[model samples]
Target: MSAKRPVRRATPLRKPVAGTPAWVMPVAVVAGIAVLIAAFWVIHWYTTPLPPKPLSQDTTTVVVSMMTGLPASEFDAVGQGTANNLIKPVSGTKLLGSTGKPEVFYLGAEYCPFCAAERWPLIIALSRFGTFTGLQTTTSSSTDVYPNTMTFTFRKAQYTSQYIDFRAVETTDRDQNPLQTPSTSEQKLVSQYNIAGSIPFVDFANQYVFTGATYSPDTITGMSWQAVAGTLQQPDSTQAKAIIGSANLITAAVCKITGDQPATVCASATIQNLEKTLK
Candidate 1:
């Protein structure tokens, strides 16, 4: 018989002591990695400010202002008075007006010759529908012709009484710097409405559009803002008449959109009436 080797007892392997220090290292590392991933996700969400979430209501305060145009405080009284006087009551059948979408106007710097001229009429027309809350009376933009261009704080701007909505968007601050990039929707609207990126381009619901006019006749001549402001004070003066005539043209267009309810002159006469006058 072959000699049998002594049998050795099998040692039972102890399960890794529950929660031992060695195991703790791997668990801590996994926990740390998970925390880092969560932090990265949170950082990404906040860093990129998302587009303005759509409000449930169709109405927007800033949107409507864009249609009428920017408000020029200096021309507040006469400009608005003229627009109010000219507005005609809309016919019952044609009462619907304004897309109710946000309106936006892109203007840059106080040095803009076009804005200098356009501001007067725009201010007047917009005031008819809403109260100008924070219009700056001094010129603020460096590139704008109105070095002391009157400023208006639109945050307080509102039109609680009027049926029409309005919006004004200054792409750049008074310093001629970008504020917010134009929205894709805004870009498309501007592209369709802006006449060659003309300063002071105006559009009312894609229905009425005016490039410039409503201030000094010398606007095309590139006169200073002070000079134009002087002309508007005397409505009957030659300078005022030239400016008013242009304003009347704008009135006609605005009236057409407001259903003539707000522009009497435009409603009373045929296109022939003002077309001849403008020339």
Candidate 2:
């Protein structure tokens, strides 16, 4: 009887709402931003152009340059001093004493820091052999000690590649990747010179090998090729003596091979006296 007045079903209760969270909007915004950023990165990676890979290490490239001759100040200072180190080559001896072509073999990479320094002296020395064409003096690697550096000069000139051959074995191509992975001949050449597996190894007529500068990499600290190059123009300066010293050693080795034709400064009494020890 009292019965059925019934069992009214209790309505489902709603969760009590605490005050709207103060950080809700901020947290949602942050998550949305994170998603957008990730999406952007993926899109950029897919859209951006990737660096190219080299064809082969054996491939040869024409050496080019825009710098014609040593500047006046450099000519007078570094050039003259460096030239003094060169002794007159023996009357009949050819550039490469015995084996291999009479080539100026260059081993270096675009990313090298020392190569950044050594290239100037090399350019100055090689200019004596022939004119460099289509050479661009660009900066070293971005991931290297330096960042996006300045441009190097590029121009074309003529020379006798027969007697004074310029075999530039870029160990790595422009993209900072290994290019010419030193052949048996190259390895042998480097070992004979007592140089480490590093760049900017210059072989003059196959007789001399210049490893790196006397001073450490900290010597001419710069963030670009321009800064590094600018330092080379003053090779004879007091601050540059260490570099000049190393350059002299290279010049001496080159001169000895080239019959001292370039009149390198390493041929000077100071450097020659030092060479006497090697002999």
Candidate 3:
């Protein structure tokens, strides 16, 4: 019986091939997955269209020309269409200015639908104080609430004025990629006043702040840039009421910062009345 038990033997354990490393299969599988992912992204890149280039000189002129606000009566007619009192007083902060002038800080993103809607009034208001060059056109993220909302991009834009100084930081583009970076102070002001850290945020000389769109993006949905600019000229239009009305209030805010410097704008009956409502 002892001899029979001795004849039994255990099965041999399987070993990797003599020349191959044990880890090679797993490494190859991981590498294959990585290559597939890279290839997918590469394909996507080639398939997607790029954002449009900076606006042409003629188009810019037309758009800027259209930004000139509507009549005081027209503004009253479309008052606050989908827009509430967006601007608020940012207390406990020093006057935000630079180079001996008041500063208007803008923080938003290209893919933001609310920012898209807000830019209309914002640009309308700013045009009264300064000029913009190198403005580009883009649409909000197609997957967002207001998909393909055609609007302007401030990324390559430059604002110039004698009454006030302007600063804009487009944190991300339509693809949600990192864009312009804001200075520490610019970011701090946003953090302090805009606790929610919402975009389309604007700071007017530390006197007032806006955390959201002045109007709803739905108003301008499905509209083209040229079509929207066309609406600004029509005082009776819904777009005019929302955009021009909001622009009037913004103008009033800017007026307070500039001491009503540019009488042509601040002294307007519209802005004067709106200025009184400021906090």
Task: Return the top candidate by TM-score.
Answer: 3
Best by lDDT: 3
Specify the poorest-scoring 10-residue window by lDDT in model 2: 55-64
Lowest summed lDDT across 10 adjacent residues in model 3 is found at 47-56
CA shift of 57, model 3, Å: 5.0
Give per-model CA RMSD.
Answer: 16.1, 10.1, 6.5
Model 2, residue 176: distance off in Å is 3.1
Clashing residue pairs found in predicted model 3? none
Select the stronger candidate by TM-score from 1 and 3.
3
The predicted structure with the larger lDDT, 1 or 3, is 3
Model 2: lDDT of residue 164: 62
In angstroms, the error of model 3 at 4 is 52
For candidate 1, write residues 75-111 as lDDT tens digits: 2223322322222122122212245532324333333
Q: Give candidate 3 misplaced runs (Cα > 4 Å).
A: 1-57, 69-82
| TM-score, cand. 2 | 0.53
| Residue 190, candidate 1: alpha-carbon lDDT | 62
Give one digit per residue, the lDDT tens place, for model 2 in 105-177: 6777766766655655566555655555545555555455533333332222223433366666566644577
**Per-residue lDDT value at 252 in model 1:** 52
| Reference-based TM-score of each model | 0.49, 0.53, 0.76
Give me the runs in candidate 1 sitting further than 4 Å from their true place: 1-111, 140-156, 212-233, 263-272, 275-279
